[model samples]
Target: MDWAKDGRDWPNNEHSRFVACRPHRWHVQAAGEGPVLLLLHGAGGATQSFRDLLPLLARRFTVVAPDLPGQGFTSLGTRQRCGLAPMAEDIARLCEENGWRPHHIVGHSAGGAIALQLALHWPVKSVVCLNGALGTFEGLAGWLFPVLAKLLAMNPLVPRLFARLSSTEKRVSDLLASTGSQIDPRGVGLYRRLVADRAHVEGTLLMMAQWRVEGLMSRLDRISAPVLFLTAENDRSVPPATSVLAAAKVQDGEIVELPGLGHLAHEEAPERVAEEILAFIDRIETKKPPKVSGGS
Candidate 1:
């Protein structure tokens, strides 16, 4: 769809901006000013996931949330780059090209994997994953979903058909509710808008088709930056134990479970999520002792 036609209606206009970089034109939104924080929404969702959370985070940091290439309003430059490794490289390149240095990176679901991928190349201070897709698919979904996505992505008419079939209010609501998340009307509305766009749907399917995380499981230990997994107790998507198991492997990895929330914890309770984020950032900063006046 042509998102430009309705750009004014998107949330957080005060801080929203677009930057053109090689392979993609990024739709980025930001607020406040201080250390840079990059917020990445899960696959299929866009910046809307952080609508309520951004204002809170912006209060303490220069929060920058962007629509990933091929998802949301961001234009996908090359379909091949939608995979995990390439997508992460493109994101880092975007930051480098735009001169935005993120000290902290926050990601939800698939975006969480992207954040971890970022730590491999960038000098980020920390990374946070909420209901992250750290584990591989299992059971019926494991065998069925990716196969369906690949078939749909390969078909030229599938995106248009899928968008037409899933664009209604009820369909969008059902999709979000299936995640065990209870979101407000505004959050639902943003999703409704996204589902109607054919390009967004196409991009989502393409990314899903190209996505890979199994390779990262073994390499998680090599990621240098500290990582935090903020899990929602009621999440049906990625089990809470995924974080527990992952934290066990890394040197500075940790997990915090938020009671009564689901996969979309940020959307359901932005205030609480922001509280945890602030505490995490504070702890990271506090660990460093003050330097002497002329030490260097």
Candidate 2:
């Protein structure tokens, strides 16, 4: 995550800035001039994930996309704070300190879970999840994934080894393919650069090790903001049904499926994903009761 070495040609680099938010130095990208729209990328991803989607959304709203602590260019403050609740709390603090009140929150995968957690405390207009990882793994994977991640995260050498092993174009392509998504060469290159960085890989492992959604899922019913879950039809990472079931629990939640897409639907079809998010937010705004003023 060296800005000079790795971020010279980064997507939307013009909008990138570093802010000293306690416990971490946040790398944030902000643009446009309307209501604040917060974009959160999934695990193992960075602001680059929204390369195309950001521009589309920026045209209509002021968009802010930040690299999660310890991931991308954001330096990690505390290892334990990589979990869902702590991440949400830290992000909330980041926003408050910077005077950015997110009117709408759009999150992908693990980011979606974090968005929901934020909604429980923050008064956001709506929550849009693109293939959110809202449910626990079924059967054996339920317990094994976290345990495996914990072991890898505990070992200091695993990340370096993983980075070295996954430093090829084919390796990155295959990894993305496993999620049932296909992206252009530039996208693949960005992912390759990320996986090749030991720090980024380590951050992703720490996040996976500490992530848990049970508490957040239990409180879905409490979120006053409308929640829109966008599930990709061909997603292989988290099943489409996960969103369906999670949406059912929320006070005002709905699900939309992106046909022929995958776990990385936003990257695969940024236009389509942007359209859904814009449409959803527009509907929410239109439904709100108009402001009342007292006549003098």
Candidate 3:
């Protein structure tokens, strides 16, 4: 009943509204009251992924949870490129529309890359990433598997296989179930419902096709925002060390490790994740990072 495409089950989420951006009617779930905190989910997720952690983060800052284009209820454009730039652009638009100025962005996995890109390009005050991949780094063979996943994603054969996934309902459920044992009933259903459409299939595959973020790693130094790199002990999805490396590059970055949590640290360990984000926000509001003048 909750998984229906129609707006029958949405009101229960609270701070609910319908915002039309283009191809789809984006379902927004806004709650709490404070500074802006835009939460971005990974490739295979919707706003539902942030269910457990949103309320906590919302305590210290307002949360704008919008399903990315083609991931949740949002739709893709006529001719779209599903990479970091476009995704970040869309997020910027969302922030602007919701009056979420001077916000902070938190991204996970693909969302993490998008968050980094957003931090570089969008008007955000700060950014924090959890278990994200910088698979675009040059000569980083250790992440060869993820890099190869990005490469193989562009193959013509992939769209065919990915497109067919939506036709069968059981396949979708099984895919989401593979993530964790005691999956959230609501989350499992949402994940299944989201990928059941062909357009969603196209949007997802396009992201896979355009999976190239490492090209912008060098430009990260240009990003002056304070970033927090939070990773789990041993995340199989996005290498934890990859995050550590990126953190070291940021002039004023802080890194925190949550022991024994999985790739989805926000959900696996929401309280700890919330605490770190709250601390990061306090740091940013205090003062700007150190700067070198043009006369140097």
Candidate 4:
């Protein structure tokens, strides 16, 4: 996406910055001050996905939200790195280079998988997943979805064709509705801008084609950080049972259901989501052994 044209009215525009992290130039937005909290949006979404949630979380923590490589304002270097493991590794390096040690991670959908992958190596205190796409497709979908995505990604003309077809306001609204979420006009507008851009569309397709969740699911027990799977009852994109089953595998995982909400639960009700996150973090802190001072 063109920052000059498309990002003119971007949410939290003042906090946005471009950082060259080798192989990719990342666009990250940081605000407030305290322990770092990294916010990762799902595939096809940008930093704007956290426009409301970021400020609320920033009230108590240093919040950092970045557009994944090849999506949003971030330019992609290696197209193949859009996969789960590589994305996590690249993000870890990005954080280390920028001196941002995330005390906690809050990821939406596919971002949730990346968060778990990061926790495998990074020492984050906790992780929160909002309507995470934690499970693979069942039966025929499991075999067909990735294959179809790969074929689409391989076609150079597909992105432009998709962007053209999906650029209308009605189309964007329909797409969001398909997720069983009803967002405001502003939210719809942002998504429209994304779909209007061929690069964003291509990047999203590439990520979808390369994404693999089985590896992460198999190693959930290895993650030491406490994880909270915030599932939305009305979510049509990913069933709430996905989180229910995935949480059972984590050594320190818990599941919370958001009633009457959908796949984009955070966007639908940022305040409520923030409350759950803050409450979860508080619980984690309270469980920690208190610090002891040495005698002078």
Candidate 5:
């Protein structure tokens, strides 16, 4: 589905939404009814991450997954670093494009960061963060990746070199592989080929690094929307400690850690995440009991 490669059509119906949108379009997959469930995939992920769960979730809500600009089939419209402000604005645009105003949101990994930004800055009703990469990394491997990314990110020749030396398919496949073997193979293949522009890849890395310095952590308290943060007990990317810190910050928030799951909590534990999400909605919707005639 390297549409950017030969400008070929994407492989699946889900991928076609992206194809139909074409240049300057962000990839999307939509289903079900009621207030939209705006899904934001991780930096390395495409909309396909929610493929299996969408059908089930769609049974209850109108689920829509948007491949963030620079990820999947979406076009990274600028060569400059794609910061959170621009990213959040595009999310607001996607919502306006689809007429999904005042929607609910669910984001995983880097998407979680975007989701948080949306809730704080946009007209979102509520949000669910799945194994989000909000706080700083803890491990030696985590510290090392950013240090390595810094050297490579600034190299103007690096993007072209990777694009020529390696197939875009090959580079993206490497990203899918990083998530773990549990990810759907077909979905991974589609994601790997969605964006042929290596510059976009470098932009993603730059955006992540910027977050490390900009520090959105302190400002999360300003987000007034109710939040349910889902964490993975075994998540290797963002630690449970990070989610714990976030839960304490958001005024109306709770954290539920999925036991034994990894970074991709929804993929590794879809039903559990879905159930919790539905329950949260239920609680929110049940604010007032059925009307009863009363005389005082």
Candidate 6:
């Protein structure tokens, strides 16, 4: 699939594995051997977003990260399938097919929203959101953004032209820079490749067009699983207040604020991000008592 290859320069090509998920061919990276921990990247990103944190996380628990539909190496399905609910359902299906009952679900940006959906729809122990997109747009943007995105995705030529026009290394770097996150060269390189690909760009456009969060936000209390919102102090894409407010609404939500980092905290400082996650997981596990022999 074109999503898996950009003229022989696939993102995280070495660890890539393909699975036939209906509607899309999934490219996943699985490692470690303990309880399941699913890592989900944001829109326009693949498994490589977790390149640094995965190995560290793998030491304590099994880690699985997959490219979302229409992004990374996953093939784009219909527009309907790209909507928030369907995207979550499809991910759940993928997990069911692979026998991965995520003991913990962690997501970045848009992926965090999906984690919430998974918690609501599946049996999950806990959820972690890294600068999650949990708020609705405001004023004219609330209406204009999705409208423009839908128009672009519907036009076959627009994505191709946009990819061609904005796929340069400088452009990719600038875009990443705008997020206030200082990504290393390697991380920026991966995004550079993604911007150059028409399929990936199209998939991103479709995702934006179908992205909806108001309904999910309205029912945040329905998410029974405990949640951890990790907010980067310098995040320019999604404000830290967004996470602070989101954490307040969930039944069991905790907020941790980190300074000197941006939206891509995992990418910028994997060690710090992984440290918090490990501690959070350990705390949750420690709270559980051991199984008693022959006890009710």
Better candidate number, 3 or 6, judged by lDDT? 6
Model 2: colliding residue pairs: none
**1-296 per-residue lDDT for model 2 (tens digits):** 79999889999999999999989999999999899999999888999999999999999889989999889999998888999999999999999999999999999999999999999999999999888988764333345456658678567888888789987999888878878899999999999999899889888888888888999989889998999889888788888899989989998887787889988899988988888888778778888532232100
lDDT (Cα, tens digit) per residue for candidate 1, span 1-296: 46567677777766778889879988899888999999998878888778889999999898889898988879988878888898888888888887889999999999998998888778889999887888764333345457758778568787788788887888888777777789998888888888788888878878878888887878888887888788888787778888888777766886778888988899898989998888877778888432222111
The whole-model lDDT of each prediction reads 0.82, 0.88, 0.67, 0.87, 0.66, 0.81
In terms of lDDT, which candidate is stronger, 4 or 5? 4
How many clashes show up per model? 0, 0, 1, 0, 0, 1
Q: TM-scores for all candidates?
A: 0.92, 0.93, 0.78, 0.93, 0.79, 0.90
Q: Give me the candidate number with maximum lDDT.
A: 2
Top-down TM-score ranking? 2, 4, 1, 6, 5, 3
Tens-digit per-residue lDDT, 1-296, candidate 4: 99899778999999999999977999999999999999999988999899999999999999989899888999998888989999999999999999999999999998988888999988899999888878764333345447647678577788888799878999888878878889999999999999899888888878888888888989899999999889888888888889888889888887888888888889999999999899889979998532232100
Q: Identify the runs in model 2 with alpha carbons over 4 angstroms from their true place.
A: 137-148, 288-296
Give the lDDT of residue 25 in candidate 1: 89
Q: Give the alpha carbon lDDT tens digit for every residue of 108-190 in model 5.
A: 88788888988877767788888777866544426644764676667766645544554566555554444442456655555
Alpha carbon lDDT of residue 119, candidate 5? 83
- Worst lDDT run of 10 residues, candidate 1, spans 287-296
Q: Predictions ranked by lDDT, top down?
A: 2, 4, 1, 6, 3, 5
